[model samples]
Every structure is written in structure tokens, then in C-alpha cells.
Target: ESGVGKELVAKNIHNSSDRAEGPFIPINCGAIPETMLETELFGHEKGSFTGAYAKKLGLLEIASNGTLFLDEISELSQRLQGKLLRVIETESFFRVGGLREIKVDVRFVAATNRDIKKDVETGEFRPDLYYRIGALTLRIPPLRERREDIPLLVDHIIQSKPEFKHKKLSGKAMEILTNYAWPGNVRELQNVIYRALFLSSGSTIEPHDLSPDLTSGLTVSGRRLEDIEKDHILKVFREVNGQKRKAAEILGVDPKTLYRKLHRYGIDD
Candidate 1:
């Protein structure tokens, strides 16, 4: 649930920490590729390897005397966990293909959506690394747990959207949004609002503008092929603003597939 608020919290922690002047580099570990993750975080020296045309500094070196925010820290592989432990313990690392050891002064602030303690117990994650990273831990409760924050978050989201500046949510729509169990968390809420913003022609966003997927709960019963097809088509349609060409570009599908979906869904020109 690392949303706008979580980022703000991270920023506040960094700003208040001793190394306020240093850079605060935020990395989403879960999103980065396993192969490139090392290179991306710990930069390489020129000619260190193929495609290493120029010398690059790693985030750890760049955040010298600063804070490094590692989001989704649990996603790191066992090898990466070992490397990270070494860096944390020694505050030094050798750049890929570089001979010299580079020292850094950095405070790490990591966040994760997984149970790291369980990971450590299961031996998927190193216990020593866990102890190093958890010098300070802040647990951010999910949106459902903090129901009182819903209205405030919704208002902030609406105000943040440029297209929805003039639009307002009807009381009923607002109620629906507030009461719904937000499984996707704050990110899902933002997407729902954005969807409503585009779909609503009037100044007020209504319940009808929301995607059926958001409201409809998927059951254990196997979903129909037609239902899956419709969902995919609808998603692509919304992404491209009902444009066949742009939808094709985004979906990486041929124009014919997009056209077929449009026809299949009975979407009018």
C-alpha cells in the first residue's frame, strides 16, 4: 500500500534524518528485472562489461551521506540479499568490473507489502539482512483498516486529477466508493477515480462510470471465455480511448484483433 502517503512518509523520514542533504534514491525492487537489478542499483565502470560504455555510479554511492529508500525489499533474490548484506555491513562495494572499493555513508529505509519475518523464517530471505534493514520500521495500515482516511484520500485524489477539476462525485457515488472493499488499495482507488473522470461527461462523477470489474466480485466458478475476452477488450478500449490504432499499439496486437474485439463487443464507431 505504498501510495502518495507512504512516499510522503518516506520523504519525511529522509528529510528529518541526519543525512538530509544527501540524495534519497527510491528503488522498486519488485518491478526491476532480476538480471539487471544489480547493474541498475550498483552502477558499473566503463568497459566493465558489455554495454558498459560509460562509468556509472550505483544508487548506494549516489546516496552517499544520504538515505536510500528500497521499496518492495522482499523481492530481492538470495544472491542480491547476500550482496546487499555485504554492502550494509561494510558500507563498501566494488563497482562491476572496477578494482577499487567505494565506501558510502547511507541510511536505508525499506518498505514491503510482504511478511518479511516469515520470509526470514522460511530461509527465503536472510535473517541478518532483515535485522540490518529493520533498524527502524513503520507499519502503514491498509486503507480498509483506516476507514476514516477514505474521504480525505478521495478528496485529495479528485483534486489531484486535472481532468476532474470541475467534476464532483455524487453523494451516492462517493458512498459506494467509500464503502467498497478496496482490494487494490489506494492505487486501485486512484484508477477508479481516473476512470470515472474520463467516463463522466457531466461535472459530477457517477457510480455508473466505474468499471464493473471494480464492483463485481469474481467467484470461484470458472469465468467464461467470453467474459475474459470482454474484459480484455474493454481494458484496451479504455487505455486507447476507444481508438483501434492506439489500442493496437498498447496491446501489441494487430489492427485486425482490435477491430475484431470492437465488433465482438458491439462497440459503435
Candidate 2:
């Protein structure tokens, strides 16, 4: 759900997994360059290439007997996907230049924001690899779908903040968060709350603490602004509780203005 928290869900999964005591390495596959991604994941032997001054352990080796979280798994290249499949199937791999194969035991938990099935149909992703990793699929619903969970998520974010102390969300602020689309998902909501926290000077947050993106109506002319604001607001909201007061203050807005919009949206008090 838009207002739901991903970190919370991830943490819950980690705690429940059998490898709870072992290291939990999380990597965003989409963020790294395709060229260096293999090296980053599987590591390279010393003198393997131009930059190989010394031997380095890949995340796979480091996460041996642990949990390896590959976020945005859909971004993996086809070649990389093939290599990964081999590793998963054979339970062994060789370093970039090393002749000897290294074996390891690691549980993989991958996630992606995109429709993986569509990626496969487009030939952008490998279907075999998908089946290998997605043995236990968990589809997290968007925030807009789970309206009831918004309030709880907001409270969780607010309490998680270090500086908020005893601060909390107002009814009006909560309403705005509950109604938002949250296209960026939990990560976006977290950022919006954080921004709101910084903008807030008082003990409680208001809608003004929210980013302008939340208030700006979507239009043909303002589409980019709307997107930017939406992303920012969702991110901040994720960080702070859906409290409009906190969000508004972080966004540097008056609480009254934030309250009015909540009413306009028809969000329940």
C-alpha cells in the first residue's frame, strides 16, 4: 500500500527467516552500473583486471550462510541473469579471473517495483530465473489500496523518528496521507515524512509540513511538478507519520491550510 512501510515489512521477513543470526545484505540492482554489477555481486580476484589491485569478496561470498536481498531484481542484464541462474543451480561460481570455483550457501530474497511478468514478455528478464527466485511470491499492495493501514503506518514512521520526541500526527494530516496515491510506495512516503519533520518547528506536525506536490493538483502543464511533488511528498510521508501537521510544517505550510485540504479530499477525521 502507498502509506505502508517497506522497511517494516522487510525487517519482519528477516526476523522470520531461518538465517536471522547471519548477515542480511541488501543491494539495489538497478542503482549499480551494468558493467560493474557482476564484479560487485560476485567480486573479482586480485589482478583480474585493470583495477584489481587485491582480491575482494563478492556480496555473495560475504553473505554466505546468510540472507542476500537483491532489490530491484528486474534490472539485471540477461547475461548477469544467466550467471545468477548458474550459481543458483550449481551453488558455485568462479571469481572474475580465478580458476577455482567457490561454493557458498546463501538464501536469496529479491524484490522489484515493476511488473516482472511484463519484463519477461518483453524479453528484458529471464523467466527461468524468475521461477527460481520467486518460489514464494509476496505482492505488496499499493498504499491507496490499503486505506485502513495508513494511520498505523503514519504512527509508526512518526515514532521511528529520532527528533520527534513525543510529537504525533493530527487527524487532518492523517486524512491527507490516507487519500494520496503514493506511486513511489513506502520509500516515497518515508521521504515525505522526513521533509515534514525538518520543516516542523513545533511539537506536532501539520499538513504544511508536507511537500507542495501533495497539494498541487495534477494537470497537463503541471505533470512534471506533480510527479516531483508526489514523489517527494510520498517519500517524506513515509519518513514521518501521515500526520498532515508534521508533513505541512516540514513543507513550511500553515496547519489550517493543511486541514482545509483534508476536508476537501473528504478524508474522514
Candidate 3:
């Protein structure tokens, strides 16, 4: 649900709507700290707080006459949720420390992988705000449910990568990808393609070039997570030609951590 390309859907709607000319502002409610969420959404005046050096526009004002996409909407604290409800009702909100209420004409689009009903039932989410945001709900099926799109999505991802423009997935590789349960969804698929591209010896990427982690989900089919990690490290080692720095980046870790893992895994690289 997290990596089901929900942002892409939001963007497509914005681009096709009458507000296409306006900015499509997207905010990840869960990513920002709760303390800063207010200022980030409504903006703060110069000297509003310690770091407010100049008058700044909030995302609501920025998306005036446009679309404001609040991703991970359920993550918004109750206070922020109440404030957001007021904005939806009045179409105007004040800056964090500003007295004046700024008016904006913007459409709101919210998304969350969490179950809003359950959250609201548990009092974690406000009913008033929930109804406001959930006026129209569209469910996006997971990648496992829509395997038909994998090849097309794979092609889209591969061709977009300049280095893999000429690369193609071998039949066995495609079979493996098709059969595996993508717990991480499209995002995981993209990573696998990138990893395959890195390890590919020719224009065609084979099954062995792909990360074993793809199969790590199914206990009966794939190796354990540790083995997947080991194979992944070895593949990355070969891909970067022993460049620890680059390999670390590709693996999403610091050089020191990468070094320690390599040592722990008994990898020379």
C-alpha cells in the first residue's frame, strides 16, 4: 500500500484537472516532525519563531487554485487534523504565528495506507476531519493483485534509466518477478530493476542479476533475508567494481556501516 504509486495517481489527476496550470503541492504528513508540521503547512511570518528570518508562504497558499496532496494523511496529529478541518470549511488559514487569516482556493487530495475507519473508531482520527477528507475514496489494489501491469511498469522503469535503456529482462528473470510476492510493491520492483541493471553482464538482464530479496518473502521459495542480504552485497560489490562509497549509497547505508557489514559477511569488498 505504501509504494503503490499513489503519488503518481495524484499527479495524474492534478495534471488532467482544470487546475493543471496551478501548482500540485504534495506533503508527506508522516515524514515531517509534528512540531514543524504547522509551519510547513500554514507557513510562518518573519520572526514567527527563532528561525523565521523572512515571511514565507505555506503550502496551502502555494497551492492556491491548485491541488494540495496530503500523503499519509492519517499521520496528522489530532491538533493538526482539527486545524486542517477548519481550512477545508473556510478555505482560509493563518500562518503559525501570524494574526491575519490567509485565504486560498485549492482542492485537497488526501491519501493514507492506514485504515481511516479503524483509526477513527479508535479515536486516533477525528470523525469530522475524516468525513471531510473521505468524501470520495478510491482504493488502489496492490501489485500482487495486479500482476498484469508488472511488465509494462518494468519497461517504464527500465527505459527511464539511461544506463538500462538498452537492457532487457530475460524470460527467466521476468518469470521470477512475476511469481514473487512484492511485499514492497512497485517501489521494490523498481529497486530490483536498478539492481539488475547494475549486475547485468550484457543488454539482457537474467534472473541471477536480480536481487534474491524479491524471493525472500516466500519462505518456501526464496532464501532467507540474510542470504538475500549477502547475495545483494556481493552483487553490489561487483557492480561498483569494489567502490565502497558508491556501494554504500546503493545499499542505503553509511560507508562505515557498509564496511562493517562487508566484514561480518566475509566479503573482501
Instruction: Point to the candidate with the largest TM-score.
Output: 3
Tens digits of per-residue lDDT, candidate 1, 1-269, equal 65535666788999988778888889989998986888877889999888889998888888888888888899999999999999999989988788999898888888887889999999999999999888778888877677678778878888897767888889877766656666677887788888888899898877788777545553212234675677777887887787878878887889997788778778747
TM-score of each: 0.72, 0.73, 0.77
Off by over 4 Å in 3: 215-269
For model 1, the superposed segments whose C-alpha errors exceed 4 Å read 1-8, 16-20, 214-269
Order of quality (lDDT): 3, 1, 2
Which of candidates 1 and 3 reaches a greater TM-score? 3
Of candidate 3, the 10-residue stretch with the lowest lDDT total is 215-224
Taking the candidates one at a time, how many backbone clashes does each contain? 1, 44, 0
Best model per lDDT? 3
Q: On residues 64-120, what C-alpha lDDT tens digit does candidate 2 reach at each position? A: 988888888898989999999999999999888889999989888888878898998
Local distance difference test values of all predictions, in order? 0.80, 0.77, 0.88
